[model samples]
Each structure stands twice: as C-alpha cells, then as structure tokens.
Target chain A: MNRMSSENNLDKPKEDEIVRIDFAFRKELAEKVEGNLASFCYQCGACVGDCPATFYSDDFNPREIMLKVLYGLEKELIGEDSVLWLCTNCYNCTERCPQDVKPVEVIISLKNMLADRGIVPKTVSRIIDTFEKTGRTVQLSSAVTKERAKLGLKPLEEIPMDEIHKLLAPAEEDSGK
Target chain B: MNKFAFFPGCMIPARYPHMEYAIRKTLPNLGIELEDLPEASCCPDPIYFKSKDKLSWLSIAARNLCLAEDKGLDIVTNCSGCTATLSEARHLLEDEELRTKVNKRLARIDREYKGEVRVRHIVTVVRDVAGYEAVKESVKCKLEGLKVAIHYGCHLLKPSKIMNVDDPNDPKVMEALITALGATPVRHRNWFLCCGKACQDEDIPANMMRDILSTVRDVEADILCLICPTCFSQFDHGQVRVGKRFGEDFNTPPVYYFQLLALAQGIQYENLGFNRQRIKPKILDKIETTLSHA
Candidate 1:
C-alpha cells in the first residue's frame, strides 16, 4: 500500500502511482476514527469460520473482504463480481470479531465507495431506483394494495414523482462539491 | 413540556397512520408537543446507503435538520432509520472538514445545517420526558397475561453511541415500556436480528419473507412490538408471504409499541389500525378483544 501524505488534496498521487487512501476518509465517512483493527486480523479465518452465508455460498467471506481492504487492495476489494451484496449487515462479524475490526462497517464503507463509482450490482440498483422513484421501497403489487384496503388500511400512497425528484435535487446538487 | 419538531418520515403518515395517530393522541397527555415539519420527504435510507454517497446522505438529513432548526425546535422522529440518519448526519456536520464538504453540496438547495437541533427517537422522548412512572400513570389498562416480544430494530440500537437509547446488547427501554403496560415482555433469541432490510437489495420478496419467518420462529413470541417502519412492514407483510411459502401454519404476532400503548389508552383496535395488519385473522381477533377490554 502506498503511504498517503497527511494532506487534504485529492490529487496527491503521481500519474502512474495508486492513490494512498488515508484513515481520515474512513473516519469522516464512518463518523469514527478507523482503529485499523483490520491490521490485527491474522487470517485465522475465525470470522469466515462461523459465517452462515460462507457455508452456503463461497462468494460471501467477511474475512477475505476485510483483509483485502486492510491491504489497500481497493481494486480487488470493490471490483469483484461477488455476492458481497448478500451480507445482511447482520453484525455477526462485529460481534464475533476477535480484533474488533468491525468488518460490518468496513464492508458498508467499501460498498458505499463502490456505489459512488456507479458499480452497484443490478438488483441493488433496482431497489435504489424504486426508492428514488417512490418514497417507499415496498411496492405492494396492486393486488396486495387491494388486500390491504380490504383489511381497512389505506393504499400505500404513490409518493409524487416530482416530490421525490425535488427531495433528490439537493443531494444531486451536493455531489458536484 | 418539551417542544420537538416532529419528522414522521413517510411511513408513519402513509402506511402506519396509527403510529402517528397514537403519538399525536398520547404525547400531549405526557406534556410533550410534537409539531410536524411540512414537506419532509423519505429519509432516502435505501439510496444513500446503497449508493455509498455519504455526503449526499448527510446533506439530505442535514437539510431536514435545518428545516426543524428553522422552526426553532429539536427534531424527534418516529422511525428509527430516520433518527439514525439524522443523528449521524448531525455528528458528521459537527466536524469542520465534513461540514464544509457536506454544506457545499447542501448550499445548492439554500439549506445550511448548523447542528443546533437535537434529533431523538420517539422512544427516547418517552423514556426521557415522561419517565416510567409517568408512563405507568398514563396507562389506563394493564396488559397482564399478554406475552409480548420487543423488537429493537437495527438502526436504533446499532451504532450505539449515536443512538444512546440503551445498552445495544440488552435494551430495557422497550421492554420496560411493555412491562409498564402490564404485559410480560419475554426475552427471545435473535431479538436483535436485522429485519433483513439490507438483504432485500438482492431478492425483493423472497429474502424479506425468509428473514421474517426465521426470526419470528426463532423468537416464537405471541406478539412482536416494533420501533421502526421497515421492521413493521417486514414482519406484517412478510408473515403473510411466509405462511404461503411453507404451507405450514405460521402465525407469528406483530404490533407497534404505540399500538399497545393505544390499547392501554383504551383506544379501539380499528382506530389503532389493527384491521390494517396482514397477520392471521386469529391473531387480529385476539388483539381486538385485548384492546376492547382494555
């Protein structure tokens, strides 16, 4: 991993060299200082040892992902076409993390970075679009809405598309900064 | 009386109207005034987290906080996700570097977050202002013989420092509230499980249904009391789908904490939106009689 200078400029990396990311961004993003507990992981596989999803699918391994992030292999960490999306953010890893690496938040931060680069998985993109288009994520098939109405509940209101666009306008404008 | 600018989030008004109704009806009796901030949009929870746009997420939440500050009141939210987002954004904005980055973006909308307002979950307000003794006094009925399970949804407890609601591992506020209502709050395994909202990104319906069923079965409680909209939707709607999946009769109980409070307040089940639930008819009947007698 390249050592980043303790400076605020985003253009510190040489043309051919990889950018050395600092813990400040992680602290700013996570709202807590990166304890760098990731450095303490010895690849004992304790985290992956008990992960339920790892047993079912080879694609999901919390320990491997944390090691990649810790090694500053951002390319491999975020570029992989794996089921990192399957992590439920269950915090089982956080609870069981011997080093308190908080792989849960680390994965969340990594996913956030990938998402900003427009590399979100397809299904995840669709959910985001649904939330963007409609204020609510749960799209009750028309039949489900009717069933709810029959049960005396008001049909889920279609959040006015214009209102959603308006709400998003600020965030959209913010990204340029 | 403490005055709070209330951000109901979209769920409380549209789908879970009874939650709004209950809070509106009950808080005044406890001397807390909840004033709604008009034109508040969805907290943009799914998009912000999924997109990993921390600045944008913070800006949106900061915008809401600024709106509340303009009204000269601290913000109180009924949804745990909203509380988490707003509170987290407030903390981020307090940092000079983060504040500059976030506000530069927010400046486009003419909203600047000064971090003057405090964002709190409704449960925190109840525990802080009303106190257990006061809540006990407000209870018109005791929920004796009612076996209740408390679901402290993920956003509320996790990231514990920001929430500060209770000990994340063993939250006693919701349990204390249930116990105050005179119900037996049962401790269950997996009580702290995520409602699988995060996993819903992959398989919209399937994962949600499975997560709800597994957790409900793990807990095996008569009724589940929740503090957030996402959890309520998952358990309420997911129970319906899960019952269809296994063909095995699975009728797990679910209700909002406020609904139980409404019942204790002698409010009618219909008024409390019990009829709006997607649970088995048998469970609804039991809740109806329980509230009616209360």
Candidate 2:
C-alpha cells in the first residue's frame, strides 16, 4: 500500500487523491505541530467543499497540500514557494475534517520547518525583519497619526524597538526543527 | 463592566488609528474600559510569522499576553489577526510542556507567559462586555435601512474550539451588532470568507476580491462591515489594486466594525478616520445625511 501510494504520488494523482505517503515526515509534523492530521486524512475532500480560496483560484487547494504532506513531499510542501503559501489559515478545512485533520496547524508546522531550514519567502522574511526591528510588522502611518490628532486623539507613541528585539532575539538564532 | 488591556496590534495602530479613536471614544461611553498594553508588539503577523518561526512567533505573542496578564486584565484586540495570535498563542501555551519551552525562550527577554489572560476580539467585547442591549440603547443615530454585508473574517470565528468567538459556519455576532445599529445585515454568498490576506503578500488575484466585492454589489449593500484591520486594508485600501489587478471597478469601502459602532454611538465621522480611506463607504454619507436630518 505504501509503495503504491508512492507510485501514485510520482504520477501526481489529480485533485484530492493519496499521491504518496511519507511516514517519517508525517510523524515529524505530528511531533512538532499542534495536530498532524496529514497521515490520517482519508482524502475526504470535504475541506475543499467550503475552502474560500479554492472558490477563487483553482491553484489554492487545501486537500492537495494534505496529500503532499501524506506523500512525504517535503519539497513540495515547504522546500519551494509552493501552494502552501496560498493558505488563508481560515480553519475551514480544520473545522470540517471528519478525521480530525486540522490541516491549518499542519500547514503552519510545515512553514516552521521550512523557515528553520532558512527557506523563508522574501515577503514572510521581510515581515519578520520589520517586526523585529520596529516591534510592529506594519508601521503606523503618519497620515493616520495626523488624522488621530485631527480627531482630538493622542497620536500613537512609537513602539519600543529594543525590547521587541531583545524578546525575539533568542528564537532568531534557533534554526531548530 | 469588565476591563481589558487593549491589544491594537500593528495594522490598526499604524494603518488605521481612526479605529483606535473610535474604540477609545466609544468603549468608554459603554462602560467598557480599555488600557493600553504597554511594550506590546505586533500580534507578530499571525499567519506570516508562523511561517517564519513558530517558536519566536508564539513567544512574542505570549510576551504580549504577559503584559496584559501583569495588568490583571483580559485582553481585547481590535484586529482579528491580533486576537487570533494572542488568543491562539495563549491557548497553545496552556499546554504545560509548550508553556515551559516557550517560557524557557522567553527567559532571555525577562518575560514569561503565565497564561493568565483571556483574549477577546473587539466584537466579542462589545457583545459580551458592553451587553448587546446596552449597544441598542446607546445608539443615538439609528442607521436604518443601510444594508451591511459583513465579513466576519476567518480568524474571528474559526477553529471553533479555540476561537470560540461565535458559531463558526453561521455567525450572528457581527450580524447582531449590525442589526442593533438599525442596519440590515444582508446575507450574501461567501460573506464570511477569508479576505485572502494570507495569499496577498504575493499577487493578490483580482478575481479573489472580485468575487467578494461583486457579491456585495449584487446585494446592493452600502459597505463591507468587518473588524479585522488586515481584511479592512485588503478590502478598502486594496480596493484599487484588486480592481487594477483584476481589471474590475470596485468602489466599495471597508469600515472597521468599531468605527461603525462609534458612529452609531454618535462619534463624529471625522473622528473615526473615514478620511484615511481610499474608497470611502457610502454608509458614511448616508449616516451623515441621517444626522443632518435629525
């Protein structure tokens, strides 16, 4: 069954079929993340039923990512800028999964694994850098600050950068999986 | 009735201070007190930060929680992402093992998340803390006949067991608030869908937002009513980009739910920050007209 699944994955099973099974990868995810329903997913396809992203773009499929994780397609899951980034983390999949497959957490775990390997997307990394440097991922706009003053509200004081940097510095060095 | 440490997160404070003005101005009137969470950082970009470093993400979020815990108040976040990160991080750290690990890392910063704070979204605060009836009674300007298409935004009502904000699939919290303000909460297709904030750091497909805005238009709704600032930006600020990207002309402006509440509570529109928007919602004008008539 394992070898057949691997072959199916190699053939790139269309849609929500079991393309492969990566037992080790599934276990690693289970151990690290909140819940790994990756291996346990029966490919019920119920997740795609309400997935808001799939309704917009065919490329954004939650179940397909689940199949990739089950097939041990680590590279497909995280090694590249794959469809995992398209996850809205809306929890639609996790909510309706009959097998208790909380796919959102698995996707987040895969991201953590990828980030630890330093395969961070430029956008994700830049946001991480911004949060580290200024304590706020997006800076408060001067226009909004000026508007606050116009509204008789005090303008926001700048976030203390040193404290945020100090708090986040420990994990910055840890590339641990 | 209950005090909450205000967790504004990054987006609302930076991109939409008018939300703060409304929240600050309106909550006090309703007898809900909010204090600033000093030394607070971002909810650290809940989705993006997790993709970068889960440990750091949880720790940073936990540290924010600790600040509120020190204040002896549960947190009330105005942004959905902030509420998600802080609430979810607090939820995850409830695990003794995970708490220890995150705290061991937090030891470097001389902070520890004791998991003492209860995280509440701004809507939840309004409904539960302020009492929905108090909201109804406090409405000085009844925005009657305004059709509000609400986007609960994913984080506000997802992962039901964790978020526990409302019924996940069929949410009435935001709808109830809208109705209380004398507006009709029009049920539209995919009204509760994700705003695609997770995917937008790349090419935000115009079709994605196109589907949403088109539905709002189909309903002939006046504006998109929501609480999440990220979703607010994607719908309001990203309106033009989503229009240009998808080549659709979308003029619907996104208003923070609290700002709307402030308006109903009688805060001036100028005080709520509608001026900062790219595409302003028609409800603003309608409310102004209502006020001028009264």
Candidate 3:
C-alpha cells in the first residue's frame, strides 16, 4: 500500500492540453503585417491590465490573442465569429505592452487575414460598401446639406468618385494574405 | 493668420454640423484660416478600413494628404479619428518601401505621397501653434466657476509613436486647454477609460459608457467636455441609450470643446445649437445669462 503512494507516482501530460505551435501561420502573419512584433511577447499581461475590451468582455483579451499569435493558432483568431472584432481599436495595448509588441496592430493584422478570406461582420461590411460607393462613410444627404446651410457653412462638396474609385482598387489580382 | 487645409472628416460635417459652426466661429478669432480640402473622402475611416486592408487605408489617407500638399498647407482635422488615420499614414509612409508601395497605388489617380505636409489635430493647433495665452486672450466672457470634465478620446493620444499628440499616460493638454478657457478642469476617476464607441459589440460599448458617465456624475461636473465628435456622440446620444439600459438617469450634458470655446468667446447661446443636443445643458444656460449681464 505504501509502495503505490511513493513509487507509482509519476508526472504525466494530458493529450488535449498540449498545444502545438503553428509556425507556418506565425511566419505568414509576420511576413504579411507586423514583421516579428508578436514574437517578443513574454505574456507579462500588461496589455490586459489597460484593455477596456478585456475589462468588459469575458472573452476578449489582448494577452491571450498575443499568445495565440505566438503559438500560431490561426484557426482561433481568423473567422467571422472570432473575438478579434471586439478590439475597439483603442490602442491602449500598444501603449502598455512592455515588449513593444503593439498588440492592437497584430490584432488588426489578424482581422485583415479574416478580411482576406471575405469574413467580416455585417456592420463593417456595410461601412466598407458605403465608403466604396460615396467616398465618405456617412453619406451627404439633403438633411446634411440643410444643416450646413442653417449654420451658414458652405455646402459639402462632392467627392471625385472617379479618382476615389481608382484609389479603392484592390492591390493585385491574386494577393494572398 | 496661419493657413490650414481643414479636414472635417465624415462625422462633423455630416452629423454634427454645429460643432463645425463653433470651430468656424472660434478659429478666426484665434488667427486660424481654414482652407477646405475639396474632393476629400473619409480618412477612409481609421479602424475598419485599415483592418481590412492596410495598403488601401494608406493609399486613401495619402490621397487626402496630397490635397493639402497641393495648396502648400498643412492639414488640421477636427475629428480625432481623422487625425489618427492621417498621422499613422504619414508615420508609416516614412518607410521608403511602404511609401513606394502606397505611391504605386496613388499613381493610378495621378497623386503621390511626397510626405511634404504634416497632420495636426485642432487641439495641437490651439495649444502649440496659437499658444494657450492666445486662447485666454480670445475669451471675452470667461467661463469662471464652470467645471468641465475633459475626455481625451483614444485616437487623439494613443500609440504615442504614431500620434505624438501628448503624454498618453498623463495627458495634461486637455486639462491645460480647459484651464486656459477660464473653466475648472475636473480630473474624474475614470478619465482614461475610452468612450468605447469603436467597439463593434453593442454590450461592450454600453458597459464602457456606463462606467464613464457614472464617474462624470460622481465628480458633479457641470459639463463633459471633449474634442472628438465620435466621443461627443457617445456621451450625448449614447448617454441616453445607456440610461435606458442601466435604468439610471445619467443626464450629463456633453459639449464639444470648440462649442465651449465658442461660448466663452461670446458667441450667442441661441446660435450655438445647444437646443439640438440630447441632454440639455442647463448649466450653460446659467453661464449664458451671466455672460449676457457681464
């Protein structure tokens, strides 16, 4: 009985607990956007301390996102329902990270990866479509024109859509994320 | 008067034209001439556009910058989001490779990012270019005894390497600007928390607004003063939404910084569009009456 307590005890690893680092995804993110910034994170969680998203949402954490980036877990980050959309783009993490990791930049780049796959929230997609069509995200309607006139301000000028269209053109035929 | 290519961005000119009115009314008194950058689009939007495609974001921002360079003038933006986008674009384009890539896109429209002109937020223009003393000199009826809680929204001061507008951790520019206007600047407990307007999820922004408004209430400030239109919308219109959800009366009146400046400069209360705001600024009415007698 005593032998089972002392001699039979051994440290063992769980199968599901082990996370494999996806170097290919990590290398892709590094090359496409941030350029080796996520690799510096030591997971001090300084970014998590100031992040409002983390404070409010149970799921959104910049430190965890950075850890996933470090582990190259692309499946968890780039998706339509991924928690990356909750970022708020406040840049608090960019200011607080001791590693100069710029976690917000990495998060944005990940969102870019999602966008590359045409996975975006409806609200974001609508804003992009509006901007693509009229140059401004908020359209200039008769009401806006009337409001400007009421203030004695000049009417809003029309954007040169011809030029804006040229600028909004996609960079290449097959630019992969 | 120093000339600037006034970039109104999307929000102010479209949604809050009165903020634009206050800006136009006050800037001339401080010796700033606003030259409109015609045919300028959105700073394409600081967040979603950039997140979707960084290259497209840089190209659109550079295109706006070119409009200013054409007139041989620097840009002065009223919206913080616009300032961030343009500032980040200017900062990133300094890399020759990135500049060439962005410029390659710009060439399709017959424009180039020469990196000639700089982008300046209106707050910086007021504090640094015009000087705080000049701001004081322009105040005809001082806002004495009026307590203003300043909200320095995220885009104005964060990612310090790109923004460089102020010390992000301990920003004193907004407080100093408030002091120069003869108003008491109340540093509330939650001064650093963002208004959370840009967060996509509805609940997150709702919760963040509750935290912000509660602190402003605790301090008993007469008005919540901020420079960004996006933050102004959150506190003004979004304040109403938060009150209904939280089942509490958070009727803190928010005034855009320039509107407060316009009031102190003796612009008539009736003309400043206070009546249109969601939360009526009853405290401003008291100050307006006092100024009328003074």
Candidate of highest lDDT: 3
Top-DockQ candidate index: 3
Candidate 3 backbone overlaps, count: 0
* Tens digit per residue, CA lDDT, model 1, B188-227: 6657666765662434335444655566566666788888
- Tens-digit per-residue lDDT, A55-158, candidate 1: 44557788887766555666666664745666765455765676767676666666766775678877677756766666544444655555456445444544
Candidate 1 accuracy as lDDT: 0.68
Candidate order, DockQ descending: 3, 2, 1
Report the candidate with higher TM-score, 1 versus 2.
2
Clashing pairs in 3: none
Please give, for residues A129-177, the per-residue lDDT of candidate 2 as tens digits.
7777777788666676676677676666667776666666654334243
Instruction: Give me the candidate number with maximum TM-score.
Output: 3
After superposing candidate 3 on the true structure, give the runs of residues whose Cα lies further than 4 Å from its correct spot: A1-18, A173-177
Query: All candidates' lDDT scores?
Result: 0.68, 0.79, 0.88
Model 1, runs deviating above 4 Å: A1-58, A72-76, A79-81, A91-102, A130-177, B46-52, B200-220, B280-294
- The stretch of ten residues in a row with the least summed lDDT in candidate 2 chain B is B199-208
RMSD of 1: 8.0
Error of 3 at B128 (Å): 0.8
Kindly give the stretch of ten consecutive residues in candidate 1 chain B with the minimal lDDT sum.
B200-209
TM-score of chain A of each: 0.65, 0.71, 0.83
lDDT of 3 by residue, B36-134 (tens): 998799997877778787778888899999999999999999999999999988998898877887788888988888999999999999988899999
